[model samples]
Target: MEVTLLFVSFFTLLFIGVPIAITLGISSLLYLVTSGIPLTIVPQKMYSGLDSFVLLCVPGFILAGNLMNSGNITDQIIRLSNAMVGHIRGGLGLANVAGSMLFGGVSGTAVADTASIGSVMIPGMKKNGYDGPFAAAVTAASSTIGPIIPPSLPMIIVGTLTGLSVGQLFLAGAVPGLLLGFGMMITVYILAIKRNYPKGERVSFKELLSAFKSSSGAISLTFLILFGIVGGFFTPTEASIVASFYAVVLGLYVYKGLKFKDLPKILLSTAITSASLMVLVGLANVFGWILTSEKIPQMISNLILGISENPIIVLLIINLLLLFVGTFMETIAALIILFPTLLGVAVGVGVDPIHFGIIAVLNLMIGLSTPPVGVCLFVASSISGISMEKVSKAIIPFIICNLIVLMLVTYIPELSLWLPKFFF
Candidate 1:
């Protein structure tokens, strides 16, 4: 009865559009009260959940991402991407994906990538003879690459949850992320040809070099963070701090895009984003504690194992489940709730945790572009001034492309594991 009440309340609140953090808190509260558990456990569990040194990376990375965005990095990235890919059949679409890939290294969040890139790309694509829905679809789909690449906020959360090395998790995601990006590019190319999308004139090598030189500072920040973490120069937390400081220097002195006046606004935005995420984490921890008390994880593990102990079948089931959940739940909230439970199931079937982490994140990132509750879809649709239905219809091909890449990463462990092993 308690478990039933817990899920009912959770889904009810979630369906009614209560914020995820509050939904989690209220559901946990209902469960505690009905089960006769003391209310004091809430604060204690939340505190314990937030009381981790690794979590410090969250705010730092958020701040760095915000600082970079404020510094006009998006335009630079888009310029570089356009210079490289604008001559292709679906030039704007290809550039959209390429821009997302480049921006992913810095922003580390899909929403940021969508908003930053979509604001520019969606309109630019429309003006350049691309359909609004297609432009929006490409923007939303490619933004998933943000969290799959390095300096990823999702990977950091996975590291905190499993005590996996953040660096290895970052490396593990690299190949899969690139695969998804390139796969989307291929989809764009085919679609562009089928639909007769226009292509830009090829730029001279000199112009491409100029574009590269212009975006070099923004690009360098990615390498800085990656090499710093993998080279033992700094931990993920320290790398975030370094990234933030570098963003400041780039924005203020180097690019001159960020003004002193922008600092307050940027800082405020970071604080709000950070605070909300922390609250969600804390409340999610409380919700997780309730699940633990009810032996939910064990029950889930047993149920999945009972279906089949074969690793391949288990992974397929897990993938389907995550893909479904991703369509509804926020990525971090989903991670906090389901990842630990699923990790045990995966490990039981001899799947490596690092590889599974990549798989799980990739699933959720794709969800960010899917329908019903796909936040990126909403953002892109809004930017394109198109209906959600149109964007949804347009994004189908890209989603299929992403799913193909997801399957490859799922079956081939080396796609995720190779880089971490080679580097570490």
Candidate 2:
């Protein structure tokens, strides 16, 4: 009865178009009322959920990403991308992918990557004779690399929830993140040849040198975050704060684009985004509290093992379940609600939490690019002025590319874990 009420109220709110945070909070309230749990527990769990030190990184990183967006880093990145690949057979198309990969390293947020890079690159690509839909598609697909890379907000949350080291997860993400970029680049190459997109004039050595010199400050931000983590100088949470400070410095000093007045706005925006995530985290904890109070994890685990005890079969089933949830649910909400339960089962079967986390995030990130309510896809479509249908069609090949990379990361645990074990 408790389980049925939990599921029914949650799905009812979700399907009716309530905000994710509200849906979570309201549904959990419903469970509290019916399940006869003391309502005082709600305040405690919500407070505790939002009280973690690691969560501080999210707001700082978000502000940093916003500042970078407004700081004119986008233009510099495109110029650098142009100088490097603008003369290839499908240079502009390839540039779009390359630019997103580079920007992803800085922003640590895919929507920011897509909006900042895509706004500039999409129009540029079309002017250079690439198809509009293709440009939109490439931007949408390649931007998914943002969260897969270090200083990623999702990675931080996964660390906090699973009790894994944030630094280790950041290290693990580096190789697979680059692999995703390479896969997208390869996809663009094939598409360019097939469509016969116009080639760009090769950049001269002087022009290449100038572009490199100009973007030096923006480029350093990437090194700061990467080196801070990989060099053992800081943990992921600390690195995020450092990266945030670096982004502000680059914007105000090196770029001279973001004014001092902008700092207040940036901080406010970051606070709002961070607060939203924290609310969801609180509500998810309440909901999960309801589940654990009922021993739902043990019950579900026994039911699954009774059906099939094979570890591979169990993993496959879990993947599908997560994928289905991903299509409609926000990634963080999904993570908060399901991951605890899933993590328990995975560990019971001897799966590595870090390894499972990489695959889990990768699969769910794909959901950001998928349809109906894919926030990333919607952001790209809005920026390009392209219809969702057109963008969806354009994304098919890129989706294939992302899937291929996803499979590699999923099956070849070495790709994801190699850096972590090697460095730390």
Candidate 3:
């Protein structure tokens, strides 16, 4: 009965459009009250959840991303991407995917990727003879790559949850992230050809060199993060601080895009984003505590194992479940709630923790572009001035492309495991 109230209240508040963090808090409160537990556990659990050293990386990364975006890094990335791929059929679309790949390294969040890149690419694509829906679809679909690449916010959360090596998790995601980006590019190429999309004139080698030179500072930040973490120069949290300091220097002096006057606004935006995420984490921890008390994770593990102990079948079912959940739940909230439980099931079947982390994040990242509550889809549609239905219809091909990549990563643990092993 307590568990029933917990889920009933959770889904009810969710369906009524309450914020996800609040929905989690309220559902947990209901469960506690009905089970005769003291209300004080709420604050206690929330405090415990937020009391982690690793979580400092969240705000640090967010601030760094904001600083870089304010510094006009997005334009440089798009320019470099366009110079590289703009001559190909569906060149702008290819550039969109490529830009997301580059921008993802800095921003580490899909929403930021979509907003920053979509604001530029969606409009440019439309003006250059691409349909609004196609432009929006490409923008939304490609943004999922943000969290899959290194310097990812989702990977940080996964590390925090399971105490897995954050650096290894970051490395594990690199190949799969690239796979998703390339898959989207292929889809864009196919669609571009089918629709007779226009392509830009090929740039001279000298021009491409200029583009690369212009964006080298921004590109170097990604390598700095990877090298710093993997080489033991700094921990993941310290890497974020370093990244922020680097972004500041680049923006204020090198790029000349960020000014002293812009500091207050950027700081305020980072505080708000960081605070909201921390709150969600706290509430999710409380919700997860309730589930543990009820033996929910054990029950779920047993149920899944009962269906079949075959690792392949178990993994496929887990993938489908996560994909379905991703369509409705916010990524971090979903991670905080489901990842621990799912990790148990995956490990029981002899799957490596690092590899499973990549698989889980990829599933949820794709969900960010799916319908019903796909936040990236909404952001892209708003930017493109198109209906959600049109964007949804247009994104189908890219979704299929992402699913193909997801399956590859799922079946082949080596795809995720190779980099971490090679590097570490």
Candidate 4:
């Protein structure tokens, strides 16, 4: 009866389009009322959930990303991307993917990547004579790489939840993230050939050198975050602070892309975005508490194990289930609601949590490029002025590329794990 009310109220609110944070809070409240648990637990748990030193990283990274967005770094990234590959057939399309990969290091969120890159790329691609849906598809699909690379907001949350090393998680995502970018690029190359996409003139050596020199400051932020963590100079939280500070210095002074006047608006935006995520984390913790009190993880473990004991088969099942759920679920909400239960089962089967963390984060990212609740998908489609259905259809090949990379990361743990091991 408790579980029934818990799930029913949650789904009801979700389907009806309540904000995710509110849905979680209300569902947890419902379960408490019916299950006869003290309501005080909600406030206590919500506080505990939001009170984490690690979570400080969220606002810092969000600030850095927003600052960079406002700093005119987008055009430099595009120029650099084009200079590297613009001469290739479908070079602009390739540049879209490459720019996202570069932008991913800083944005740490796919929607930001989609909005930041899509705003520039979609119109530019359309102007360059590419199909609107195809342009949107590439933008949306490639944006998922943002969190899979180092300085990932999702990996930070995952590290907080699992007590895994944020550094390890960052490194673990490197290969798979790059693979996702390269895979999409390959897809674009093939698509360019098939669709007869236009290309740009090859940039001269002087132009390439100038572009690289210009964007080097922006690209260095990724290294700063990774090296600061893996280099034992600072924690991930501190690294986020460093990332923001560095971005500020470059944007205001070096790049001249941002003004001192911009700081207030950047901070305000960061506060709102970070606050929403924190509130969702708090409420989701309350909902998770309800599920755990009912031994839901154990029940889920038994349910899944009842179907298969082999780790590979079990993993495949979990992957397919998450893929479907992700189509409609917000990534962080899905993480808070499901990661613990899934992690428990995976660990029991001898899967490494760090490896599983990469897989889990990567899986939800795929959803971000998917429909309905896929924020990046919506952002890209909106920019392209195409319907989600059309963008969805155009995105299929890139999705296939992402899936292939995902499978490689899943089955060959080395692809995700090697960097962590090599560095550590």
Candidate 5:
């Protein structure tokens, strides 16, 4: 009965358009009140959720990305991408995908990737004769690569929840992240051929070298992060701090793009974004505690086991469930609520928890591009000045491309595990 009230209240609040964090708080509060538990438990669990060294990466990484953006780093990276691939058929579209992959290494969240890259690419694609919906579709789909690469916010949250080696999880995502990016590029190539998309004249070798030289500082940050974590120079949390410090230096000295006056706006933006994420984490922690107290994880495990014990079939079921959940739920909230329960089931059936973490994060990242509640979808569609319905139709093929990659990551554990093993 208590669990029923929890679900009922949560769904009710969600359907009524309450913010997800508040819905989690209220639903958990209802479960506690009805069960005669003291309200102090709420504050206790919320603090427990927020008090983690690993989570320090959230603000640090967000600040790093924001500082770099103010420093004009994104524009440099896009210039490099354009020089390398922007002459191909669907050249601008290819540049969009390439830019997302580069920015993903810096930003760590797909929404940021969508907003940052979409603001530039979507309009440019449309002005260059690309259909508005297709442009929006490509932008939204490529943004999913953000969380799959290193410095990933989702991987950080996954580490906090499961206590897996955050470094290993970070490495595990590298191969599949590259795979997803290349897959999207392939989709773009096919579409470009079929639709007769325009292409630019090939750039001279001198131009490509000049573009790379200009973006070298921004590109170096990507290598800095991967090496810092992989070489044990610092923990992922500390790497974020290092990245932020480097971004500041580059902004002040190298690029001279960020000024003293920009500090207030940049700091305020970081504060607002960080505060919202931390609140969601706190509330989701409380709601997760309620579910645990009710043995919801065990119940879910039993339900799945009742259907089939085959690891392949079980994983397929979990992936489908997560894919559906991603279409409507916020990624972090869903991770906090569902990760442990699903992790337990995955581990019980011989799936590596590390591999499962990559798979789960990959699934939710895809949701950012999906409709109804896909934040990336909304961002892309709005920038393109089209309704979600229009982008939704155009994005379907790309989503199918992503699902193909997700399935490979799911069934082939080596896709995620090989890198961690090779480096370690």
Candidate 6:
């Protein structure tokens, strides 16, 4: 009955278009009211949720991403990518994927990736004679890599929930993220060739050298983050702070692109975005509390064990459940709520949490490109001035490519574990 109320209220509020944070908060609050729990607990949990030292990474990373944008990094990345790949057939589209992958290593947020890259690439692709929907599709699909790479906000949230090492999770994500990027590139190339899309001309050696030189300063942001994290120079959270500071210095002094006057707006935007996501985490923590109180995880574990003692079948079931849940719930919300339950189950089955975390995040990341809620899809459509219907149709093949990669990460634990084992 409690579980029923939880789901009923959550879905009801969600159906009525409540912001995800509010939906979660209200649903959990309803449980409190009906069950006669003291209201003080709400404030306590919400405050506690935001009190994590690790979570400080979220705002720092977000600000760093924004600062890098202000520093003219995206333009440099695009130029650098074009210099390398523009001579090939379907090169510009390939450049979009490659640029986003490189940029993803820096920004670590899908929405940021879509907005930053799409703002540049969509029109660029269109001017080059690529159809608008296809341009938007390619941009949207490639942007999913943002969170899957290091300095990811969602990984921080998930790590906070599951007690996994954020650094390990970040390292685990590298290969899968690259695999997704490469898969998207292949998909775009096949489509570009099939439709006879325009190819860019080869640049002269001098032109290539100039583009590389121009982009070198901005491109260094990626190296900064990768070096800091993988080199053990800092923790992931600490690395975010370092990255944010580096971005500011680069923007203000090096690039001279963002001035002192821009700090107010940038700080305000960072605060608001950080506050909103933190609220969702707070609400999810409370919701997770309610689920724990109701013995939901135990019930779920029992039910799964009853149906299949085999670890393989159990994992398969879990993968499908997460995939469907991905279609409906926000990824962060899903992560906080499901991680506690699923992590335990996976561990009981002798599956590594680090491996599962990568697969779990990649699966949900793809969901952001799926229908009914796909934030990335909406962002791309808005940027491209295309309709949702058109973008959805355009993204179909690319989504398939992503799903194939998701399956690889899911079934093959070595892909995720190798980097962390060797590097960490």
TM-scores for every candidate against the unseen true structure: 0.99, 0.94, 0.99, 0.98, 0.98, 0.96
Model 1 has an lDDT value of 0.94
User: Model 3, 4-120: lDDT tens per residue?
Assistant: 999999999988889999999999998999999999999999999888889999999999999999998999999999999999999999999999999999999999999999999
Ranking by lDDT: 3, 1, 5, 4, 6, 2
Residue lDDT tens for model 4, 1-424:
8789888988999899898899998888888998788899988998988888888988899999999998889989999999999999999999999999999998899999999999999999999999999999999999999999888988988888878899999999988999999999999999999989999999899999999999999998999999889999999889888989999998999889899998898898899998899999999899888888889878889999999888898789889878887787788888888997898888888788899998899999998887666778888878888999999899989888989888988999888888889999
User: What clash count goes with each model?
Assistant: 0, 0, 0, 0, 0, 0
Tens-place lDDT per residue, model 6, 1-424, is 6668888999998878788899999899888988889999997887887788888888888899888888788888899889888877788899999899988988888888999999999999999989999999999889989889776778888788768888888888989988999899899889988999888889999988998887777667666776677787887778788888888888888778889899889999989998898888898888888888898889988888788867787788788788778766888899988877887888888889999888788888888888766889999999999999999999999989998998888888999999899987
Residue pairs with backbone atoms closer than 3 Å in model 5 (clashes): none
* Candidate 6, pairs of clashing residues: none
Q: Model 6, residue 202: displacement in angstroms? A: 1.1
Candidate 2 deviant stretches above 4 angstroms: 307-309
Candidates' RMSD to native = 0.7, 1.9, 0.7, 1.0, 1.1, 1.6
Model 5 misplacement above 4 A: none
Task: Please give the range of 10 consecutive residues that has the lowest summed lDDT in model 3.
Answer: 45-54
Candidate 1: pairs in clash: none
lDDT of 2 at 20: 84
lDDT of 1 by residue, 187-250 (tens): 9999999999999999999999999998999999889999899999999999989999999999
lDDT for position 30 in model 1: 92
Better of 2 and 5 by lDDT: 5
Model 4, residue 249: distance off in Å is: 0.4
Name the TM-score of candidate 4.
Answer: 0.98
* lDDT per model vs. reference: 0.94, 0.82, 0.95, 0.90, 0.92, 0.86
